[model samples]
Target: MTHSQKHIIGLVFYPGMTSLDIVGPQQVFSALPGVQIHRIWKTLDPIKTDDGMIVLPDTTFENCPSLDVVCIGGGLKQQAIVDDPEVLEFFQKQGKTAKFITSVCGGSEFLAKAGLLEGYRAATHWAMRQQLMSHLGVEVGTERVVVDRNRITGGGVTAGIDFGLTIASILYGEDTAKIIQLLLEYNPAPPFDAGSPEKAGSELVNKAMLFIQEMSDLELASSVA
Candidate 1:
């Protein structure tokens, strides 16, 4: 595929977003020599991550084209859902035009509020799985990544790479995905065995629960506003 036909992929950056969730897949997808990838934000100015890293986006929300593919990642500032009408409107508009729409962790909530995930099977970080169901009223499953039609969803931070590869497989073909996985040397071996929610136990799960609780009001307000 030529550069123009490769697909325009956009990642929307927000405050408190999981750096890995957005960047990891971005790294993998952008590596496709043909794809044109960009980081977009509410503004074209440089934005900072929760960890104090600043990133300059390729474009602002007002000007970004109707993308071929777009991914939203979780962040601390989800209040934008209700607090920023422009963000919600932008998401709704993009969801309609984009060929594929996906999210990581809490990002799915935003999509749901925009009325994109209704009647679709989805997934999110182990922490937000239940919240996604309760708030969005969508049937969600437990998986590292779930691909249902054009809407792809995944668990937490590390899940982005898997999500990207999965989407690449669907869009470009299984062969292309395998080639990228091999080239990226993505053989993962972990010392801890806590990738699944069943094994994380209540304590670790509660910590994540508390964190989401703090953001709960934001989502509620966003949904209403």
Candidate 2:
């Protein structure tokens, strides 16, 4: 397909993925004209989200067409994916030809596991940033969205919107991204000032860190077993 007609975006969907990480970006890209979004998985079966939502995959890894961009979203099952050779292979193969390889939240963990994030600066959930650096040996950035060459990663769950808009600007233009942002009514006025660890204060940050620690322990166990 010609450059003008090519706007294929493949989003990897797997069991236990954070729905918002995928859906947030999905909505933004879906709003753009001529952008074809594909929900890809190992099979066309329905995959359950972390919140117990059922998401049906539209394309299987074996049958997926060439994509301009490939994205994966973070969730609790990242360790499972990291240990799955088939999943890593799929990402490794796609990263070879995809114009852009990106992830949101802990999804960058999968990319690092697949050896796709090596030598590229990436971003992930703040809680998992240390683990990402310690385990993957990748340069981690604390930004909402990080772009190193064609590897783009977004921090945390909500950062997916920012990541999507950034990609939108790259593919379409800043004007198109602004139009999509307006259509989504993407203005933010969070009621609480607890979005980040710095703003959340020590008590809340400690609680969140405990949960992250537990998850990291489980991930470590799973990875070695």
Candidate 3:
């Protein structure tokens, strides 16, 4: 197959976003030749990550050019963005023309809030999966990476790497993706088998659920106040 001339991949950056969510994929996509990665936001100011690290935005919503792929990464402040009209409008506008609409972790909530994930199978952090289904009414998949047409999503935090590889394969080719993977030493052998709810058992799952619920409740309360 003939390659596309060039591809532009835009990643939505916002305050309190998960740094790894953006960095993981950013590293992968930016490694490929002829692929331009844009860190976009409402402004070109530095945005704080959930872990308190600050990242500077490379492009503003108004200044960003048309993109081939639009990716939104999740973070603690997802609810704030979900409720932002400007952010949602930006997504809606980009979704209309972008070749692929994707997200990682709670970023799927942003896409769903923008009305782009309707009737599409998407993935998000397992902790937020149930809330996403109940609140946004989108089909949530539990897989590490779920691709429905051009709407792709990654589960939880570290899944961003997997999501990146998937997008790489689509943009370039399987060989290119494999080479990138090798360069990154993308091999996993966890010390424990408690990564998922099934493997971690109900005790761990319930604890995590409670923590997520508490955070959500606090965010809602703050929003209402």
Candidate 4:
């Protein structure tokens, strides 16, 4: 594809977003051919993630081009952006024409809040599923990756990789996506089998929830500090 013909993909950036949620998908998309990726935010200023990693925005909400794909990564700070009219309006506008509107982890909450996923079935971090249903009345999916029409969503943080590969297959082809997978050596051999609540059991799930709550508390404190 020519420079002008490259697919424009915008990844929304915000304070306290889970880095893996963005990075996993970004890595997959970055290796694809004829694609331009933009780290978009309300401004070009640097923002700190939930883990204190500083990320710089390459484009702003007002300056971003019409995107073929628009995605967001979820974090504790995602709740803050849900109510921001600027962000919601931006999504509302871009979403009208974007070929794919997607999110990872808690990012679906942002889209739901923007009134973009009202009739769509989406996936999000399992922990946040109830909140989405209760607060936003979103139809939640139990899969690691959910695709309803042009709206795609990934479960939790690490699921972003699977989500990206799914998009790649749709955009390019299964063969091309397989090639990218091989090039990235995207083989999984996780030592533990506790990736999901069903396998992790009640005790481990409870512990994980506590840890997540602690992280949320820290994020809240940092946001106000």
User: Quick one: best lDDT, which candidate?
Assistant: 4
Residue pairs in clash, model 1: 16-75, 16-76, 17-75, 81-222, 82-222
Candidate 1 lDDT over residue span 37-83, tens digit each: 87988887877775667888888888898898888888665544434
Candidate 1 vs candidate 2: which has greater lDDT?
2
Better of 1 and 4 by lDDT: 4
- Models 1 onward score TM values of 0.87, 0.92, 0.93, 0.94
Spell out the clash pairs found in candidate 2.
Answer: none
Q: How would you order the candidates by TM-score, starting with the best?
A: 4, 3, 2, 1
Tens-digit lDDT track of model 3 for 1-225: 235568999999998788999899999987888888899999998898878898999999999898899998888777677789999999999999999999998999989989999999999988888878998899988899999999999998899999999999988899989999999999999999988887899999999889878877886787689
- In candidate 3, list every pair of residues with a backbone clash: none
Choose 1 or 3, whichever is better by lDDT.
3
lDDT of the candidates, in the order given? 0.80, 0.89, 0.90, 0.90
TM-score of candidate 4 relative to the true fold: 0.94
lDDT accuracy of residue 217 in candidate 3: 86
Clashes of each: 5, 0, 0, 0
Best by TM-score: 4
lDDT of 4 by residue, 1-225 (tens): 112345789999898788999999999998788999999999999998877899999999988999999999898777777788998898999999999999999999889988999999999998999999999999998899999999999999999999999998888778877888898899999999999888899999999999988977887787699
lDDT of 2 at 87: 85
For model 1, the stretches where C-alpha displacement exceeds 4 angstroms are 1-4, 80-83, 207-225
lDDT computed for candidate 1: 0.80
Backbone clash pairs for candidate 4 read: none
Candidate 4 residue runs with Cα over 4 Å from true position: 1-5
